[model samples]
Target: MKKPVIFLSLLASLIASQSCTNLEEQVLDESFSPSISYADIANGTLAPVYALLPSVFLHTNYFAIQEISTDEAILPYRGGTDWGDNGIYLALHQHTQTSTDPNLKNTWNFILQGISRSVSAINEFQGKTDATSQLYLAESRGMRAYYSMLTLDLFGVVFVKNSVGETSKVIRGAEAVEYIKSELLAVEPNLSTTVGPGRLNKAAAWGLLARLYLNAAVYRNVTAQTVTFSNDDLDKVIEYTDKIINSNQYQLSPDYFSIFNSDNHSNKEIVFAVDQRAELNGHNRLAYFSLSGDQFPLPAFPAANGTDGPAITSDFYRTWVNAYGSQDPSVDPRFYKQNLSIYSNPADSCVTAESFNINRGILRGQQYGLIRKNGVFLKCPDGKMKVGKLYNDTRNRPTTPVIFTEKVDFTVAGSDYSTGYRVEKYEFSKKSSSGRNLGDADIVILRLADVYLMRAEAKLRKSNDAASALADVNTVRASRKAATPPPALTSISLDLLYRERGFEFYWEMLRRTDMIRFGKYEDTWTEKTNTDRNKRIFPIPQTAIDGASNLPGYLVQNPSY
Candidate 1:
């Protein structure tokens, strides 16, 4: 294998100096020696490309638009003070975001950087004839396609560039869909099946193709009131999903929460995920972001606490309530996981020598966790750790108990610290005991359950195979082996399927796309009443548009942003 030593050295130096924003330009301009064959460039050469994923998918970046912008999540101005961020979150939830929103801008930069790095890698490996070089080149193209899919999904445009310095063709609508599909199809054969979910593999490519085909209608026409689903496209979706299902490389995990646990990198359920192992720069914001500030999960480090970020919206919660009816959602394993057994009885205090795990899933009502006093964890009478009811001591409502309410108002007066129900889906990494930085849990992007659901949806849409679709849906529903699992549905409709997706994948950053595909994106939910079809895709960052201004119509912002 040929090593691109010069490329690696420059990348490291650029990253160290915080001049990574010009990574694409630097890599393109600096010529690599032809004697340094692509064969020597081992798999580690692709690390820089994959490294861009963590920041792009960070809870506060792309996750915000994918979730918070829809009814699934909301980050209100906590206690009329925190998370205000000049109304960026508020505007996102309200569908009033502009080109200058920091979240959108940062997300754009991160994703574009991924695309650039992938392009550079592809260029480096181009024309290599060796088997190893071909395999790596295929993986690079696959990654480029994956990032392009995200770009098209979010900003409604795909920048198709063959090389770093060459002008990118801004593509959207059907053109964008076809380009991505071609890229994935072109690389699918060379993708290694033995690779892990963290890396792009054959199975991951199949999953991405299935997803692209399943949402082909939406990608083609973002604002259509009744987007037509082509039977051929649906069949393609089914074909690809069936390929993955038949591969037998993955299975639905019996423990739903286990799929999102800190040590879930080896879990079979995950077909594709952002690898957030301890060695990588991963963020614990997904776990601690929605938790109450005073409720610290890790007793070993009292300073590592929550920021009281986004919470599950009441409108989204109503979906679960409406489905279960009278039965609490907590009964379903997917809805909530009670990990803190000692805190079952809030009044009972326990002494622990080590750190304890907190409860996971959608948290509602009064909260309880390890209490801290004077910058240290409060200890029990015997000099061990103590657990007690949590309060809003960190915010303005110091005296109020930390009881998460079902309803959260958009206004400052009504949006208190404890308003909306918070979600704690991902486990807080013990490695990140002191801050919100080092997370080890791999953020799931594609999984087997989702694959089954996509196939079920394809079956339903293609030929209205209700019996087969029902079986598929029931297969997922039965996979969650809770003490009393959610019973199988005898019948399934498109609406029922959409609701099932919500129940299975809430807070996983699939809500906005699901809502849009199901024709529910424009429906008024919580504080968001804006039904403007143009808000379907966010505006292309003004900076990006200005950067290309000299090229004359090189980049156009999305409609009505």
Candidate 2:
């Protein structure tokens, strides 16, 4: 799938000179250069789109802010004595500015770049007789549609452009959805059925379409938007899910932890994932975002990695416990595998309830002593425990282990254990440090489990198909070895669906969209309260506003702006 050298050069020029005085001007100038062939331009376009995925980890991006906006998670750090207020975007998101913030702008930029690349690829395949080029062009369309979904969700409007040089045509609401549908339908002929996950395939395009239609009512108030589901949308969702589930290209992983394990990449459970290669591609800070210092296992963890952990709020953890706990909390396995808690123990010998205790040793005593879910807690050369700045008792010092009931937060100033749960998704080896560790874990962007859950949601909404919906939901539950799946899916309310989504897709980047779709976008929480309605889309960036003049209403700020 390697492309021509000219395309590579075009990509290099755009990415390498990203910091130039005027980005739009620089890109526009590069687009007009006749030396670059259409084929070269199309081939080079993908480099930046792939490059953009990694930029989510960039400081100015929405990775952190979007999470804060959703109820699935929240940061404990508020305007406090030692905490950094910059993470305030989380609070601001919950409260104000939906149309244009720096985060919103970055998101807009990210998806547009993705769309641009896809369009470029589409143009490159125009004259090529090669089947591979057509396949790639189709994949590019799917990618654009996927990104356009995000853009519409976050910004309420996004520009639709066909070629690299064309000015964007701003489309909003139904128009945007139609545009996305058109792209997917048009490219279906060329898209391959077998391209594995992380790469968009024909089925994946349908999945996105299903998702878009499922959430249509929320985006635009069609009649019965909340209570009524369109039969057409429901059918599309089912059709798409059927194609993927029956395709045999993917399936649910038997072990919950196996999905997150480094060795289990490319497994059947994963339909697609952002392939993060340490040192080569780009590493997702997911490792750094969800980790807590107190419970972190490695002595060299912080030195080797950035420890800006996002802890689980006590509320969300309680929800998981209430939903799955069978009298004993650890019975679920997912709670233990996906999160770090006081009860987590590293010793493989300790299996059942009685053998496991949160208050065991210096490494298991203090707040930071809690065991991580998947990886073993490592010991120092002196046999003492390792502690981060959050749990480092000044009086006790790092060398000495505080082996008692001293309460200290095991998180950084930028984050707090406001929710009281931190994610343990990626399990790095005891010997590994930083995201560079061969923790070659595949980040599941789409999986069979999610498809099942989504089908249940769509079915329940479409025709009160509670029995069928329950079966679909329970299929996943049964897969998890739940002694008894929810009997008959009696409570198929939106709230229940949300809880199901929370439990099923926790820590994935879908939370913000889920919240928005469920009419919970404007709601308030522990550290987040609605600032205004326009804040829902994020403010159009000041920079963008400054750059375009004739685009008067074209760049009109979202509501409350």
Candidate 3:
């Protein structure tokens, strides 16, 4: 996070300065401050573009569209209140989301705001004649391309902005893809390979290019019965992935969990990430989104709370059941989770406090963590550490303390608190000077592991190179030191590739696109059955359409809205 500390400090100073002056007078007019140069503003202008990432990446917004909508995750209303939120969660999973949905509208506007900021940064950088100005210009253009890619991915159309405050013309399908490709390629040489995690660079741009081509067929023709992956696109995936893999700039992290730790800014695994800091308003959704309220870690921390939202689907979890039956992640080396225990038995742990330390994968069976009892932690029977019932905290109504269990049937009925296995992929940020909920962890957007997986998939899809694909997949598996390592598969198939992606990149914002490309998004799974083929892309947010009223026909809604 400190690699670009100068730019970060400048941006912070500008934000702090805005608080001292009247809001109305801070406009980009001739009345601009005589003390500060426009170059100074241009240098820090990318801050707004960076600011929009957290909102887009948060679990309830863009993440909701990417993951929750697929079979990987779901957030059901506990006791008809905790997460009902007008049935947006249910609608997303069920593929019945309307354009007016708050999440959809908010996410759409947030990405547009990023586009707006990118345009502003470019204009400001234009006025400055310096080496630093060119760097800023390239980074700004890269950011614009990234945001535009997201807009095009989620909603088929992207707004075309020639300059600031101009009416953006909506470009969809093939046209949008071409624009994004051209923009990324244009900025690639100018982008600094130095200073990353917080800023986009050459490697990140290459990763983005790889992603675009990998999904180009789907982006160009979503309505095709089976989207065709051309050899050129597949080669591009391999070409760009090799650039990162052979560049020697990045490598897979030794500790898989450390890649998501609060101190992950230095992790080599990350190609591009949101440098969320404890000092700033960072997101903690990945840390506690699925955790029960009573299962607090380091409860001594003040005012700590977990929303108890999303949990992985049973079908997703069942992917682990291989030819050898249910794989115990303990020995599975790389592709496994720590074993979860239910009680504070001396047999499991000589000291009860030791039982609370659970594994870092799909959490199932009885859960154990710090439990409050009469202002102190209560120990279990003959057990050393504290234990108590996990109350269903919907409406703050403490329902009967129930032991956590796997309810194979997900989409729990109203008030049926126990169901799907909770996901704990991101290392929880318990120890931080700044707020834990606003965590310190840098959320990784692209990584080396993903690069490897993408290569494997591209190889499989393009040339039926099963042996090479299997080797790539196994390389990732071998990297992790699981207590019980699942043996690497001897053969590879499209189905295995799809499951491997779920195993490697489940909670990350890539599931929905993966499901569609794999031809599984339309299949029935758990609570989701009404999957109309056309629902692959969400309806363009109604707010986006209304906001573009000034442009008339330019912002036509995508197909069915």
Candidate 4:
């Protein structure tokens, strides 16, 4: 799954460079020369789309909007002043985002940026003559379809652009879903079989189809109702998932922690990902966002401070409690309760120097890592590591020991650091003084374990079939576990499947989709008590509607905006 050398060269070329995301794409046809071959230009067509992935899938982008809106994660303003971006996180958790919420606008703009880039790529490689060129064109369409699917899923609308700078048809509901599905299937045959990570390939297309099929009913329903899963839809889910599983193109990671490591480009389980390298322009916010200021993962490196806030809700943490009943997180492969070790390396250039086994999954209890004393990490007298205590960084108790907790009140007045259990799914950058604010590891857009979980859900929904679903669930559980094996269940249900997904894919940007599909989104959780059904899909950004010169009346806001 290493990055292609041509793709690396594509990143360095001026042809791949992009103007502002909000701006129009300029035609670069005349700039190509005899020295820069046609293949390079064709590959260069894909660079903008690849570059836009990080903006859409990063921790603070779609990942936060999707996960924080549900119970999987939250980023409350620390001590009331720090993260209080006009109460975006609180409003998100409460399902109260308006058309003016900056978070929604940011997410919308970034996804549109991706769509615009994909369109530009499609227009640039329209008359390619080589297999490589055709593959680039196919990848462009596939990437376009992928971005459109996200747009449809989140906003319930898709902008149909036949070519660059063309007026888009405002497609909504089932029409949009069909458009995205058709686009993906059309390019499925042309995608490269050997496309590496960060690039969309046939396997990724299959997974996307399965996801679309899984949610086809919801997309069609528009209005909230009990979703009836058709046998055909279930078959498509099972079929597409099996295609990825049987192709042997990818497999579940033996160590779940390795999947999120800073140097995880080699993991075979990653079907498609955002190629994020510190030197190649990546951010470390995924790891740095949740970590407390005192709990430094890399003692020698102080690149960017970890702004602690993203943590699991009590309801989300209670899922494990209901399943394991105080069982140690080590017992479950998906849950890494403690972040104990680091991967230390000083000699490697263009990579973070500090490295250790920083744990993955949900974190609870007293936080322990390198403690910053004065300017350096403080050690212990008994030779054991010193556990760090977080403080209410925005309030009167900046130095007090603010222990982490699972119970959180979204409407409470004071900001307590001990509101919820923190998550460390992404590896932190080990650079002591790296200038870049981005993480070194590529953010995983889709992985094999999640696909397996989808197959399991499809089986359960098809006919309450448990045995087949159990095998798939246990398959992932076993692959991610230590020496001790997870107990195989003799039965499976929707509740079990939901909890299993929570264990498997927490904070990877699937929680909102899972919660909706399982019919648990409307139920009260943590600080969210909104029962309005319209809150399921976000309102189309008002800015977008105002900016839509072509589709003025067509770009209507979603209901109850």
Candidate number with greatest TM-score:
1
Better of 2 and 3 by TM-score: 3
Give the alpha carbon lDDT tens digit for every residue of 85-159 in model 3. 888888888888898787776676667767877887887777666878888888898999999898888888776
* Alpha-carbon TM-score of each model against the true structure: 0.92, 0.77, 0.87, 0.88
How many clashes in each structure? 6, 30, 11, 14
TM-score of 1: 0.92
Worst 10 residues of 3 by lDDT: 16-25
How do the residues 1-561 of candidate 1 rate in per-residue lDDT, one tens digit apiece? Answer: 633222222323334233223222212223346855433454545766787788778887878999999989888887777898999999998899999887787777777778877887898778978888788889888998999999889988887878765667788999999999999999999999988789999999999999999988999999888989999999999999999999999999989999998899999999999998887656646888898888888876778788888888888899899988999877788888877665566655775746467889999888888877677888877886787778877764557899988878677655777888899999888877355777899999999999999999999988899999999999988988745678889899999999999999998889889888999889998888999988888998776666565556657778886
Where in model 2 is the C-alpha error above 4 Å? 1-48, 57-62, 78-87, 98-100, 221-228, 294-302, 305-308, 324-328, 338-390, 393-419, 429-439, 481-492, 531-533
**For model 2, what is the alpha-carbon lDDT of residue 9?**
25
Winner of 1 and 2 under TM-score: 1
* Top model number, lDDT: 1
Error of 3 at 155 (Å): 0.6
TM-score of 4: 0.88
Off by over 4 Å in 3: 1-42, 127-129, 323-326, 333-359, 374-402, 408-415, 431-436, 482-485
